[model samples]
Target: MSKRIWKYAFSSALVLITLSGCIEEKNLRPFILPELVNTPNYLVESFPGDSVLLIAAEGGILTRYADDRQYAFTVSNYPVLDQIDPTDVEVLYSGANETFWLRSDSLIITFSRERISNYRDTTAFYRPTRFYFDYCLSDDGVLHRIDYYNEIWDPQSGSFLSDYFLAIHRFEPSGSGLWESVETELSVRSDLLSSPNAVFKGDELLILTNPSYHVSSFRSGEVVAEEIPRESTFDQVVDPVWNTDDVIYGLPSEPAFFSPFDAIIELPLVAENSQRLRLESACSPSADVIGPVKVLKWTDQEAVVYVQYFTNQLTTANEVVGYIYTYGLKDGSCDINSVQSDPILLPFSNAIRDVALLNTELYIGTESGLLVYDFATLTMVPYLKNLFDEETR
Candidate 1:
């Protein structure tokens, strides 16, 4: 045989061997079933009928999670500051709209549908000795900002200067004109906490401090500051939700540890009314389940509470367990029923920050990521991982 012919035959044999190996490798590869993945550590807060979900995450990242059709966008630019910290950042969304406000260290950045604008005033009116402010959006589309100040002490004079007062600014939008700023009378006080919890009920702004709740009317400039009624030591209110017409729901700040017994207080907005209701009596689950109340929501028919609990059975150390307690309120009565989740599907930590319900699915926010609990399957799934996995692939 000729040398050229022999060489050709050898090359053809090598090619066939390579093709056979490729075929075998393809057949041997196992199929991977798609599983849930962790999303950005976002505190999920959504609005009704709104396609975009705004989240306040770590590293000063403002995440905009749109509908499944669009990709997520993040905004972290703070032009005035050298480094933006997420711990100092507070995000608020315009209800049922794509607009959102990001307040971080004395700067307020507004993210509209088309543009982003930043606001900060170092002048006498809006100036802050400390870099912090708390704000809320009213139902009439007015932005209420509360600037906090601490009392300055003079060691030379041996007296404290009364500089503690809340400067309330109402940013009202005109007839498609620029937002008009109307300043109200400075509610004089000495014990104003930094970044107090504020919410909007209809047109009134409800501000909750340590021992008092300040109810202000933006239209008439009427400010009412009243002490919080002390029924129990556990009445220290935290995370107040303006769920209904006249009631504000909040979890007690006491008993910080995990307990099967948890209480949710329904506080009235009326100044003359000190009557409060404890919602814990309505929630009765098995003794093995125990957790703290993370979030509360009230609908026309039911009041839903999200609790992070664990079972006594053997499970993975990183497993997350929780329950969705839904109370059917009939004539101001609560009939509670809970849906327990499987242990394997829960987040690793019990740091669930927020919760919202859309249709029949329940969405939860935790330190790890966003989780979705399906009412039909009685299962919990990681949201962000499943959302962006296909994009990465």
Candidate 2:
């Protein structure tokens, strides 16, 4: 063959091998079944129907009014800050003295005793766009590098978790912060879900079956899971700064989870014959799953649950919710109705609402006021404002 013909033949052979390899890699994972956890109301979840009121704390005892009729703080006290659309705030980490950082959309704000700062486009990696927390909990004690345009989760070690990452559940930094980590995952009959929500106990991990909203603890050297009534999967659990407590949880998918038509025919995480709890709410018709359930805090007895609502059907062009709900152990649930309703009143995007609990306070990261919780209380300091201002300058 001529030189050109020889080259052509080699290219054709390479193409065949590449195409064949692509077909073989379609499924790199093998099939496995979801391990059934026999518990009551363990898997199925519920969310609140209406919006909740979240007050914007502007240092000391000063708080601003709601931007709109909504309850959460939509605008900040700082004149130079951009308004945050109300989303549930996530990861409230206290900073040096009166400073703290709010992670939203890959941007980390350093709210000092002053205002909001402008931010570059960035985000937390593991946290998807609609996912509430894209930021990890951090403080001055730890040094975090800017990785993946500020999107990647920087292991406290400042590098990737390689070789045996799957076997390693706890990512601890010796001198990072006064905080650590907790990981929890939802599995249905053996299939591993997206995020693993773990509750950090000083020397223990209170693992919820995701089977029964009930919880049980596991220490570093203990087995992977302990028993919790052979049932009881928590709807959501959040671990705050305190070294010894875990906020436990339970849930009801609210207006949507109770849908008379497509309601979960079989509760996702409970006994085969468990009865479903029909809840009350005022969500618009055709809302999909009530919302993704997560922990604002968890303890053996008392626990706080955070639920975000998406009321449109699967057919809606783009359905999103700016509402959050909190539920507890007793006979009452608090609805913090601090959210912005006017679509065009803030930044131009489908509303993305998120929340985080720091110390004894709650901060809502939205399209309006970046941090609405009161700082100076030594809990969560506002970083979004600082970040916003830094960039703006």
Candidate 3:
């Protein structure tokens, strides 16, 4: 369908869906976590080929859900609190056999086969480098991290007190279940704004820089940056997802108001043609914001894009609430207004920090806990409750 026609169709469907009370109501339940205190962020990851999920919440809380059994690791049982507090978890990611969580101070926690190990790579976790902006894990389990740093110059001493750096570091696992810096994969000593987004297509690492409109690829100790064609300039690119193909789906810094709708951009890392896909909010008339795009799996014809939507936009104060939608994808593009499906509302009290999908259910991690939303029945449930009483392992 054409873009305009698709928008109008979605508008009509949205009106009907809204009027029919299709959007599920908020029925949030409490998570049974004992030591989850003063935490407002949570990240989630799903184990491949199994019905298992791992949730990492702020305040140094980690929980796993396998079928009907829920297991948690907190300060009481997990003695690693001396190394880092429960509130230190800033990012949570999963690899084939291991799950990694980054602390606020750059301390990393690696979980494998029910064992937890903590390590800090001083080479990459140097001073003045506060946090990791974006990252991706390769098939071989190496983590490529993009971080920003700045320094001040002192002219009287004829030396630089501080300087700015945009670096990409590779962290590989060691024999002791810890991680060490393999190398400083790519570091640029420039003042240009860097996008915290990176993806791996086979062996090449693709990265982006804002305003500069350049996508850099790193491989075999060589870094080559190609400027995105001017016709497809973006203010910002966040939450990039890469499939087997060369194209990546990323959310622009902000959603377009109305005209010339810009929701998701199809960046051709190596291809010549660039395409921008349209995703308008049917629930909100004022704004059409899309949070992040994650490709659960890709097939020969289509891929399932799990996206978070920020609806009910207002000028003075936005609602800060939204639902989950599955945009249709084919031929390396998305059909936001696909006739095959309608937008499903999975409301959470807080903004979505991270999401993981298992089968027909979505594991949504928020500040409170993990929400399990069933796509088949359009219902939601909260997990990680009563955590402190018992510690698993």
TM-score on alpha carbons, each prediction: 0.59, 0.32, 0.56
Model 2 Cα lDDT, one tens digit per residue, 226-324: 334433333332222222222233333322222322111112223313222222232232254444344455333333433455433231322233333
Candidate number that wins on lDDT, 1 or 2? 1
lDDT of each: 0.53, 0.31, 0.51
Q: Decide which is better by TM-score, 1 or 2.
A: 1
Model number with the top TM-score: 1
Which number leads on lDDT?
1
Q: Please, what are the lDDT tens digits per residue for candidate 3 over residues 178-217?
A: 3333333234333444445666655666556542223345
The per-residue C-alpha lDDT of model 3 at residue 385 equals: 31
Better of 1 and 3 by TM-score: 1
Off by over 4 Å in 2: 1-168, 172-195, 209-225, 232-247, 250-329, 332-393
Q: Name the 10 consecutive residues with the lowest summed lDDT in model 3.
A: 337-346
